[model samples]
Target: MNLIKTLIFDFGDVFINLDKEGAMANALEIFEVDTFPEELTHVNCRYEMGLITTKAFLEFYATKFPNLTQGTILHAWNCILRDFPKHRLAFLKKLQAEKKYNLILLSNTNELHIDWIKNEIPFYEEFKSCFNRFYLSHEINLRKPNSNIYEFVLTENNLTPSECLFVDDLKENTDSASKLGINTWNINPETDDVTQLFDVNKRLF
Candidate 1:
């Protein structure tokens, strides 16, 4: 295998653990619904893509569930995010110090998620400093599993798809990158660790 020149990483599940099921339950309870509404999913997509402001997003939820407060809606939305492991940060820092490969963070995250991270994680800045480029979906107006987003990163960074390794927790995201000729690792958060990068994909290194 050819040596990897750049490493593109996903944040949720890969770096920070998420309670996806729990968050879904929380949202259902907050909205008082038996199942997730289709409109809510559309709004969420817009929110993630930065097509809608946080205020507008919250207002949409407020209009749907008038009984719930803004705080409750925000809390339900942020329930998916959990702790950021220190060891992963240490591993990333070491990689940055070595400067062997260009490190990039590409996450399908919104303002509220980032706001929670900044307030909850004491070393949020320190962790971010390790990355050569940090691309949040909301900030970039793009989301994963979409070819345009992957193409944008490759074009912007002047990186060859074959020389870049993309690691994401979602199969669809990894599959999309693989189609672009980028090496990919669809990491399982339950059994895998980002710190095991070199050990897991030794051929690339």
Candidate 2:
């Protein structure tokens, strides 16, 4: 706890509530797919990493699912995002005010989703202001569960992995960071909240 000088957080399911299951169900129903095919998955990955423009990304979907309207595609894409709790912002602001540790926000998000958030969440800029560094997978072209993304954060910030605590909802992502000697908390979004960070990870905090 004492050694941790940096706190790395995942945005989705950490600060912002995401209806992943519901969104997936919606997408499946809308797209008429039992599961996303590899091509769609690959294109999604590329879009997240900013390998393609939003126009191109939307065009891909439109080309494939011509019957579906653009609004429907956009709706299904952004549906995963839900309300962001203000208590989490309060906690983060307090942490920032204390100047006790470096705060960083890391998330695998694409342009449309971020655009939607910025437009929807009135306090989006305020929330972003709390972090020393904010890395979006689309902006950085590096998604987590991939070790290099963690490595890039460590290198770019000149942070010692052992001195940093990375919190994410996914085990695979935390595991990747953990392998680099970073302290991690694989939080279950259903049962945990970032506001309880210090209390939840007593050993680390």
Residue 33 of model 2, lDDT score: 88
Ten residues in sequence with the least summed lDDT for candidate 1: 24-33
Q: How many backbone clashes does candidate 2 have?
A: 0
State the displacement of the C-alpha of residue 89, model 1, in Å, after optimal TM-score superposition: 0.5
Q: Which predicted model would earn the best lDDT?
A: 2
- CA RMSD of all predictions: 1.0, 0.9
Predict model 1's lDDT versus the native.
0.93
Q: Candidate 1 vs. truth: CA RMSD? A: 1.0
Clashing residue pairs in candidate 2 (N, C-alpha, C atoms within 3 angstroms): none
Best by TM-score: 2
User: In candidate 2, what are the lDDT values of residues 76-187, reduced to their tens digit?
Assistant: 8999999999999999999999999999999999999999999999999999999999999999999988999999999999999989999999999999999999999999
TM of each candidate vs. truth: 0.97, 0.98
Deviating ranges (above 4 Å) for candidate 2: none
